[model samples]
Target: MHSIHNRLFLLFLSCMMALLIIGSYLYYRSTTEIIHDKIGDMAEKNISQTAGLFDLLLEGYDSVTKSLNSNYELLRLLELRDKETNPAASANMERSITNILGAAFYSREDIIGIHVVTHKGKLYNYEKRFAGVIDPGFTDTDWFKKLKDSSGEMVWMGLYDGSVINTMQKEAVFVFGRQLYDLDTYKKIGVVFIETDPKPIWAAMSNVTISPNSRVYIANNENRIIATTEKDGVETPSFSGLPRPDSDHVIVDKSTDQLIVAAKAELADWTVFGLTPKADINAQVVEARKYLLIVVLLLVVMSTALATLISRNIASPLKLLIRQMRQVEMGNFTGTVNVNSFEEINSLVSSFNRMVHRMDELIERITLASISEKNAELQALQSQVNPHFLYNTLDMIYWMLDERENDRLGRVILALSHMFRYSSDWQEASRTTLRQELDQMRHYLTIIENRLEGRVRTEIRIDDAWLDVMLPKMTIQPIIENAVKSGLEPLNRPGLLQVYTRTTQRELCIVIEDNGIGMDERTLTELQTALSDGSSAIRGNEGHVSAANGGTAGDRAVMKRRGIGLPNVHRRIVLMFGEQYGLRIESKEGAGTTVTIAMPLPSKGRKIDEHTDR
Candidate 1:
């Protein structure tokens, strides 16, 4: 009893309110997730780049030490003994080694000092003073012990006070060293140390931090903080949770509101960590939520008023049109809707009436065409039992009788007569058992073999168990005829034709293969195309049947004329069984051609009776 406008207003308002609530929640959740993913990706990339820079720095210092290992003068000086007896030679050697160390120091700006400590309580230092044999107790230090235990590989020692070595530059420095060996003796001679300024590594670590309050630090495999951008924050950050070394690059801790991203450094088994506050990252989204709320409220009010006006004008005409549509759906195409509520609605009603009239005409035409095509196909199949095959066999038998009148001539004539009688009897049924079909094929082959006289050879290997399977009459014989005419007759050498049957649990396959001169790819494609279209072509006109079944021409010409047999067989198989059971042909130019007849196995419970309907 309610007017259309009142009902539409309430429905539209409720839908708009629900959509606004759901849309806002989805937008907020999706946007927040995207932002977090982007931030984490940025953090991982920055830390990886920073770790690469640290590796490059360490590699450069290690290269300098490698050059010193090959320096023969340095090796000779470390191997020197009896310096007291040969004081002049010793003094000259000391000056030579000092200059070699100075060249390495000037090669890179980051190298603060290079020191070599021999096992014999002697030291060679390259710094501001160039002190020779300055500290004899350096071998007892913990850094020296660790370097010796490194087994000749370079080892990184954490930051240490620089005042112990040189009082001029008192700031902390990063130290790394390796054990040196004599080139020829293969014995440990001394240890070489390279100390670099740690500012470059610290600078790279600081750039990955997102905010002032956020902390960035590097930790070793032992979970010890080796370096940090914020000294105090390393000891007393609000959150101290660390991810496992093998965990993903980023992790979120909801309890602490922190997003932690980590990357492994390439050189020292160290991990870089960037800790950021989630609240700071999502501050902009909180502000956007407030504006979204106001916009949703205004849209709901506007949509409700517009829906009421539109529904009132559309309701009456649509109701009349729907009533006529119901009648059409029930097969009454004569009814028409009569309404003039709006211009669009009036045009729609006019189009519906015309469409119903056209549909009725189309259905009647399709039904008549289908019935006519089926009847024509059946007629074409019946006409394929041509009498020309009998005339050709009889003519061959007459030539043999006039020449020698041998027993083979009589046998060929008997087989030819049997084949004609079997093919001509079409009143019994359209389908026959496989045993009858194979026996008919043997008759055809016997005539073909006698005429060719050792030029053609054939083999049949059908299983006795498959003899009772039902199929269209004279199906395989036509394919054999085509093979002999088109595939064998053109060859100069003796041709081989093989007929075989293969049975599976679900289907039966009859294969005809020939070692005759086969068709090329282009000719085979055209023949297949013609066969697929032949079913409709033969049914549409009577002249096509004559062209396919009657002609006085060569073997190829006769094949082109009798091509209807292949398609006629294929169509009969499809109509009786289904589209899935049909003929498939394969051919190559020089090798051969093979045609397969694929059909489903007959059910064991079904009897082969004289029933016409499959």
Candidate 2:
């Protein structure tokens, strides 16, 4: 590992050295190639710009020619003139032609001049110097001569100006002209012409820039080299550049051979070219490698330093911590953990000491609590009345009856038996199997029915599968008692009471509904108050009403008067299963009430609790 680390560092240095060497070469190549590539990209971008520019300029030129050619009204009057007979009338027609000419050039700054040539073998123009000429030798000027000679199709002359009569006003420019013919006669009437300046197109192409280093240029397909750049104006054919060698786009570098070129076609037989240097791409790659080598070296050096520091500072503290943890594992957290090497290690020791202190404080509290709890248990034991007192009292009564009054003894025995047996209340957590709660509820119901036999009707409906369900002790008996007491409220009129157990959505639902003197909202509210308060169960000696609703006394009482049941079974269920499976009370005044208790279905594999049926 040591040797490899040494070799790795050396390899790192050597690789960096090699990268520097290769990068130096690549950078050199990239830099030179970048210049060439830049020029080519510039040239290509310029080609596109130039093509767009050329089209825009062609639009202006075409509009000028169209404006002049489309004036068939002017052409119609001129074609009616008698050339030899009324020469003066021809001069008057020439003035209207000049007025129309000025309108064509109004927005077009690039059109140098415009003119019209009538087909009566008379050269009629807007200019005074060139007006009213009878070239009655019938077609001598090349523009007129060509229109009369052709089959009268629209004509576009490439680049010429001698087609006009005036010699000096014509500085040579591109010409666009077309013939006007009468539809019926198929006869040539006159020709319209417009001159276009190419500088407008060049001006539109001027802002072409491809890259910071790139150069942009355009060349005529016929061989005019018109190049524009960020630092240079339109390049003439005499500028230092290669001739466009027939190919649409091909890179050629005078400084170096690496090049990328793009070409676009412009209007009027013009081809635009863009040049890009190949070195720009290589330079970016080499620069990336140069950055990569720095990152690797920093990682190597930093890792070695961090690993050494971690071993010296962190590993020792961790070993000490492992030993301390073993003592804690052996059940000894009384001693202090020691660390002074680093802040984190010191923090761990401080935390360990604090935890040990907290445990000590907890142990002390627990010891005192255990003593208090024992005292409380002893006090509770003292408060419990001796069961032997009643047993002795009953024994005494039976003994007396055996001696003399046997009738009184039998009556006394029955009363004493019921007092202990029927009033036995179990704790909450003890589970009561469904069958057992039902039996207890049945016995309680029998007692209630006996009291209100002719007044009310009571029914119990239980599912067979639910018979084995285990619920908390005393969950149903209170409900049965409440149903009877509340449902048989008046001495005369009575209501129907129904108890049904079924399964709904994975829960056992114990629904107790009453059609009794269905409560008013106010009475129902009092019943609700009574059911909620366990303390409200015993109101000065009528007997204890187990809190059915599990609410405060007032809320329990409000529900108590109306609920027919305080929903105590609902509370016991939620206490056994979570709060999610709890009481849902839906009641309507003067109609009926449904107190639904939902409990979770126990898992099949759980062991049966010994106290389940209490």
Candidate 3:
């Protein structure tokens, strides 16, 4: 015997443990998804808004360049060629252009310097100190070439050091350039370059990042990083792995533990990438998981302790019962178990005490009646064999052979003989493999079909996998007999019988269904009541089985003549495999009836014994 306390404790613990594990997994998964989605949405919104701000800033600078291009005085000065011959006229034009450039520079506090490079290699600069210069090599610079090749569109030339004229100012500045054209000639004459302090743009990007380690940068269509916010780590933000700028707003790259959100600037062919680490984005989820794990562990401990106490309380009564059982096994039937616990356990104790008392009394009288009772029981067992069925079957076979003498008659005789021999040969064991049982049922079905003259059709649809399982002998045959006699025989139309098998995680099921005259509601209720009444015998008095089958007097007599009924089969199954495995019946008045025999899968090397008739 095993310790009932431990079994109870483990059962409780296992149930709670499974529930906790499943619940925790679902909670963690949902929380992580929610956190990821929330962070992605926020990141996308922030990047989009920052891109808008950056575009507006660029547009403002473009407007300034357009205003300068339209200045009549500045246009005339650039078109003038006599500036080299007339120093007075050249000096006046240079001062006038300087005033115009200075007025545009002071319009925005962020503007650092503005320089104009003419196609003739002449350079003009306007800055905080107005230190102008005329550098001939300005046309050879990359920024100047980019501006000249820009056609008529404004070009943002990324961040660069201070201009040549204002080399003393070491601060970095973002430069915008455009090619200036002579309106009347339709030819490019000069390039206008405007530089702005990068502090404001950097501030916009910095405000868009939520984490300290996060990076936000602007990249061209070629994926070159133009500018980025101040970064503390060596990890450089790359836009090459991001999705197309017109696709989804955010992309989560779990491989790199990063979430990237991107937006395209409308003013330029530049994309803004905001990269945030997953660890930082899911920080709350991580903390929640940690606390949930702790709580689950604590709950496990508390539940275990509680289970121990409950199991002890429940096991106390069972332990008392076992002690009494042990005493009885030792031939002392005077002792009885008495323990107070649940009502069910208390009832069990009461029944056990009553049984012991009865056994004690019976033991005193056993010697006086042993011989006579044994002889009577033996005679009853021997008489239990119903000779009428065999006689009728053999007589029918004889008549059929004598009258018809066809292959059909021969087949019926052969099937009947096989069924008789199989049922009578009880010398080997009470249990048989499911395959053998099915074979026996096949023989019985063959005989029934022949007798019914093709009025009955049968179908068997059981999986071969469970054919090797062991079950009680005569388990399915009796149910089939009941279906044929009570359900099918009375039907006016052709009858169909089906036998199939199903399996669950723990139990195997064999189902027998018949399209015959079924029982009404009242008869079914009474039959079900009798089945559940904990009785070992099914009574023929209530008409529960007979009425359901539309039983005639002859059918009732035949049923009574046989010693077994559905109840007997149910009792045997319960005795062998506990109450969890047994027969279930479902029936309708006009349709048919289905009977299910549920059993546990047999373990390896385990043999089940058939219970004696009660």
Candidate 4:
């Protein structure tokens, strides 16, 4: 046992096991105590608040009974009931008494009915319409007897499953009654019973519970449960030796697996108890302890393996260096390697750390240089687009002149001049407002309408509010030209090209739709694939354009030569923003094509709301 290996093994195992067990016990004890105190306090406060609410509710019922008890007209009407000998007069007296009862019934929403029963066996009720006929034998009921014995005071009869006065009233109700007496005679004239729905009482009890499985009980001064949230057949725990009626403090009973918090409802002369299963309260603590055990076991096993590793391996520093080297090979060069060992090994580690530092610096420089070169190339490609577009515009002018179409030649020339000026401002042309871009597009459209002889109709439905949004210059014109030439030109019908904007929470989309000869599936697929090819776009290679709209070889060649416009725009948008913002295209054989340019919305989007509200 004194051997170095055996001694170290036992020492490590014992120390780890002791520390883990002690720490876990401490954590478990602290956690359990905290949860118990916190949950008990919360439950106590909840019951107290609920009890206060019940006090207020019962006080309202007391006030309602007091109002009926002291009303002079009601007492006089009841007294006149005995004196009226004629049948019709007696019936009128009964109506007057019910009228007073109806006033009280309407004052409160919870009241199901207001009932008055006299010693002469006369019954008057002001209840809900269609409440069914009154029970004639209600005078003989136990509740009526209890109310008759009350000394001109309100008697809360707790909750019942039905009304004693109405035959068909079977819903749960909270009932209270009071004896009405004449002011001068101090004599009992009749007894008033107010039957109200028990929803308010149930709500008060439910509000005091901590969990869905927790049971709340309301017990009278005699320790008899008057109202409870316990379901039928569910046994309730005994609440023996609860706090006195005058005590405001809660009595916390911690049994084997249950926690009971009891508080007194001072005004109602009742006790409210919330019984919650301790299993629900300690569920989280148990889970934490289970995880602690698992972690402790894992640590013990790892400690044993570490002791064996230290005993067997004398070159731990070299092993650490090798691990760091493998991490470097995986391209994680963030942390340096430091090891205490022989001079030669330490020297080697120092050299490795220097190498990693230099390599990390070189990698950062290369990344930045690559980004700069990419940006320069994108700028060059955008510069090439303007001259190419100018050549096409001049070619259109030449054709019009050659065909002796002199009527619209001046209009085309004017629009061309405006477009040339707009395109020449290349210093800040990398980005411009959407309004400027649309203005340039309008000029181009003017020339197009003249060149195509009204064969193409352009509609720009962009809201004026979106005019200030900034985008790359010449973005819309290139797409418009492509649509007019490739899609609208070959159409047998008049082409309608529409431009509009759509928005969402994350992005805004500019949609260009054309009711023209749309591309077939093969051609559309090829175009989409070319646009997504970043390498080809960065290398500025002319991508292949498939035969579109069932056109001929010459048509395919024209499209092939002009396909770079879309790719250029897609690449520029992605390079400016990120990979997520780009163009999306949808087309069907004869259903036309919709090209949508999706980009992030502005920071404020104050202009967006102007159109979105519509």
Please tell me which predicted candidate would have the highest TM-score against the true structure. Answer: 3
- lDDT accuracy of residue 540 in candidate 4: 20
Ten-residue region with minimum lDDT total, candidate 2: 540-549
Candidate 4 TM-score, C-alpha based: 0.49
Which order, best to worst by TM-score?
A: 3, 4, 1, 2
- Please provide, for model 4 over 480-521, each residue's C-alpha lDDT reduced to its tens digit, 9 standing for 90 to 100: 766776678888878888989988897878888887677787
User: TM-scores across all candidates?
Assistant: 0.43, 0.33, 0.52, 0.49
Give the worst 10-residue stretch by lDDT in candidate 4: 539-548
Question: By the TM-score metric, which is better: model 1 or model 4?
Answer: 4
The CA-based lDDT of model 4 is what?
A: 0.74
lDDT per residue for candidate 3 within 579-606, as digits (tens), equals 6777888888888888888888644455
Once fitted onto the true fold, the runs of candidate 1 whose alpha carbons sit more than 4 angstroms away are 1-14, 81-89, 128-141, 161-164, 233-257, 283-614
Candidates' RMSD to native: 30.0, 23.4, 23.9, 34.8
lDDT of each: 0.69, 0.54, 0.74, 0.74
How high is the lDDT of residue 209 in model 3? 93
Candidate 2 lDDT by residue in tens digits, 1-614: 44433455555556656765676567656765674456556555555555666666666566666555556766566566534356687667666766677777665766655666665444444433343343344355565566556564444444443334455554545555667665556576776666556455446555443445545555554454443443546333332345453434434444544343434443344445444344554456466556666765676566556555645565566667777778877878776767777787788878877987877666654554344333323322333355346545766676777777675444445344333242342322245687887776665555455556556677888978678877665566655555455444432556677889777555668887776444556555655555454222433112212212222244335542222123434444444554567555555654556667777755466553322211
- Which scores greater on TM-score, model 1 or model 3? 3
